[model samples]
Target chain A: MAQATLDIPANKIWGGGTSPFGASYGKLMMWFFLLSDAFSFSSLLVALGYARHVHADTWPLVENVFFHFPLTHAHLPLLYVGLMTFILIISSVTMVLAVDAGHTNNKKGVIFWLGLTVVGGLVFLGSQAWEWYTFIVGGEGVVKSIIVDGEVQKVLVQGANLQNNEYGHTLFANFFFFITGFHGFHVFSGVVINAIVLYQATQGVFERRGHYEMVEKAGLYWHFVDLVWVFVFTFFYLL
Target chain B: MNHVEDQSLHYSRPHSRTPEESKAVRKKILVVTGLLSLITVVEILIGVYFSKTHVGEGTWTLIKWFYIILTLVKAGYIVLVFMHLGDENKSLRTTVLLPMVLVIYLIFIALFEGEVLIQYVQEFMK
Candidate 1:
């Protein structure tokens, strides 16, 4: 029985040698890193969930907080965020195209799609910066109590911080800043990595190696970022 | 000798699918993108509808559940198609997905314990 078991191929027993799962070393490593990152993000979101649960009665409504529209005084609840989500999703589509092109060794196709992806990322980052600024600047006519000549007077309170916010609870802004800021940082680094990979592709580095696995790895990271955003959008905005 | 080595490096054949196969792949990608976009649009519509309407407490809770389910569906589809996890071997898929169970458990416990703490605080105040 032991001899018969030994006769079976190692690949048959353990997927494959060294890789053990048919994935290359780098791809497997990327998956592990993503899994760890996922844990961190999930924990943060869960913490946010706890906060929301505790403050269920007084938690600021997402629609009321994010109501401003671009270049208009009209309140467009979730319109801008919807646009941002669409842009990110479209960028993810372009990234898939780039990876598909890589599979076929189409350098020009990869370059074009990758360029579009980078542009999409930059657009998203710009939109996020504007959003953060808007959040900090806050809305007009929001009032908080102020001590004036030993008398408490109601005055407009703007912006947000750890201690004070125009929103209902300071925890809301805290989580928003922390979670979205962390995600934005990921997008920034992803764009940088994409640019580097694009440069390498142009130089025929992957072609020289007879594979575009680098592009595929980068694509995995991009998709993971988009995946995380889906959850964030649901938890923070939709729910 | 250097020229010979360079030629060898340049001439190695990468995997090349035929035009028909490539077209199929493109179609699959489009389908996945369409599905994801559709789910997102539905989610947005539901959110807008519920916000505009004064639904019962039970109905509101149901809608929130819908949002969470839809989000998970979208996330699952992306991981399966765009990340190519669906095409990967069983062992590889398991390696990537199995650990996620722990995270889910963590979330459940955190929420439960957090609720308990909230109740405790409320009682203490009374």
Candidate 2:
């Protein structure tokens, strides 16, 4: 009897008479998908770390690079990022609550938590926008420069580092914008999708079916977004 | 009752797991969340204040590893607590997480490669 039950055999949907494994087939695949995404993000971050190491002298100091109004007249370190981090963490919390509500069949709780999660996501995106604004519109304005013979030259030339100006390379800003912007895009998309799910859920979409895989899947995506932020925070902001 | 009856009863999905003891799980998750936030702040503080202070030579190297470890700790917590990977069955977790272990090993090798090359570059800085 135990063998028969454990045999969950191949899921008949696949014509195998069982799911090929335990647990929801779709969710298992989502986990696999996330694993691949994690690798891709890690590769990008590792490259950033390598570049930072190779350009140590020319890399813009991040603490001094990022801005937050209350801290610095011009460039403050880590304050905006800290806020963003908190917002993301809070969003993750709300997402968990949403999942909990889904599990417990609480439609109202699901909507509320999902709504809060989306709001937190928006806040994080707003923080990213401010961060990007500071980057694009630098204190001295965008210094189009290039590295010349080991010294940073302040002229818009080909193959030169824009991250560091006469102060540092300009390539630093390029990477910073590209990497963070990409992650911000992920957060933005996640928020949109989450809102859609929440909206559908509020309309009693998944509740009648007596299942909550949508919430679980959305939670998976949210966790991935948060996970990527950890790498970004460690390599880009902290390092 | 023979083994078959016992086995049948044990294998069946409990008619009742549905009323999610959400209250307990909620409390557990909140505690985990608070701990996660605190650790992140502490890690950042260490990076901010200690990195600038002039300690003995090689402190930067030590601190670099320290920061990385702390970040790893954060990652572990997020995976285990927030992602529900912790309570998952060990076999499933291993199947899913094995890739991550391999990636970290590769990252370790990559770090050494970059570090060695950077040291060579820094030698010419003076």
Write the residue-wise lDDT of candidate 2 on B1-126 in tens digits.
Answer: 453222212221223233356567878888978987897788667766765434554887787777788778888888887777786556558778888876777678777888898888779776
In the range A1-239, model 1's lDDT, one tens digit per residue, is 46444676555476323345766767888889999999989998989998988887768889888877679888777878877888899999999999989878899999999999999999999989988888888876368785788899887778887656888787999999999999999999999999999999999898778778788889999999999889999999888
Q: Quote the chain B TM-score of every prediction.
A: 0.83, 0.65
Quality of model 1 by C-alpha lDDT = 0.85
Cα lDDT tens digits, model 2, A1-239, are: 36334443233233443343345656677789888888878887877777776677767666666645544585445756876888898899899888777766678888999999999999888888876665555555444544689986776432223434332565576677678878888898899989999889988977665666678778888988998898798888887
Candidate 2 root-mean-square deviation in Å: 6.6
Pick the DockQ winner: 1
* Backbone steric clashes in candidate 1, count: 0
- CAPRI rating of model 1: acceptable
What would the per-residue lDDT of candidate 1 be over residues B1-107, giving only the tens digit for each residue? 45323322232234689889989999999998999889888887777667824788789889988889888899988999999999888888998899999978887
Candidate 1 Cα errors over 4 Å, as ranges: A1-10, A15-18, A145-155, B1-13
